[model samples]
Target: MATDSEKLGIKIERNPPESKLTQFGVRKWPNRWGCPPSKFPWTYDTKEICYLLEGKVKVTPDGSSESVEIGAGDLVEFPKGMSCTWDVSVGVDKHYNMG
Candidate 1:
């Protein structure tokens, strides 16, 4: 596999038979699998727009213990300085934007 830094800005499409792809701090996708993965809190230095293309995730904020499950076609936004832990369950395919 080639590094994204070594390639042009491209989009990875998740279609039938092919699933699960991650692009650095750009985007990730998991198809049909249960319980995607647990990840570290993201306190983005840049604004992040997360749109749930499928499945559910438990998003727990830092400093505060509040969490929520956002699923299919849902939208979530986090500005700079916001930190949170992401517990993705029942798989997920989402588009991400960070710069």
Candidate 2:
């Protein structure tokens, strides 16, 4: 089934299969962490694929009224040039790759 993110053109896989993770070499990706209860604006210069290891977050694309909620076990892809605001309600730990 398609998620809200998918509808917005953001790709998200909820608890994808292990084979998919291995195919993507997710373990080799760099890790990032963020503290909770914070908000920040960001713009992606390149496409990014990330797998969340923990925490919850809400990302609202610029000029959009809806927000996409993400949390542990979600694998998400953000297309290049997408501007957004990240609201972290729980701390985050994740692995990410950019291209």
Candidate 3:
């Protein structure tokens, strides 16, 4: 069965290989850090690919009841123009690129 993330058009790969990270040059991407117990709305102006180094979060797309859970060791992609609310339960540290 398709996961909630798939249904929401949010892609997530858990604990991907190092080669894949290297292929995407994930280490070179700019980093983003967020503290826990916060909620904020965000809209993606461009597609974003990120690799989470630490922390956990739940992102609920606008107009949806479900939230997609993401955490450390995950590689995730958020589509361009997607509007969502980020609920950060744990502090986050990640590398991200937008295009």
Question: Relative to the true structure, how large is the alpha-carbon lDDT of every model?
Answer: 0.52, 0.86, 0.86
lDDT of 3: 0.86
Tens-place lDDT per residue, model 2, 1-99, is 323348466788988888888899998776675576789999999999898989899999999999888898889999999999999999888889899
Ranking by TM-score: 2, 3, 1
Model 1 Cα displacement at 81 (Å)?
1.3
- What clash count goes with each model? 1, 0, 0
Question: Against the true structure, whose lDDT is highest?
Answer: 3
Return whichever of 1 and 2 wins on TM-score: 2
Candidate 1 vs 3: which has more lDDT:
3
TM-score for each candidate, following the candidate numbering: 0.56, 0.89, 0.89
Clashes of 3: 0
Clashing pairs in 3: none
lDDT of 1 by residue, 24-96 (tens): 3224522223346666566678766555568777777676556765666544556666677878766777666
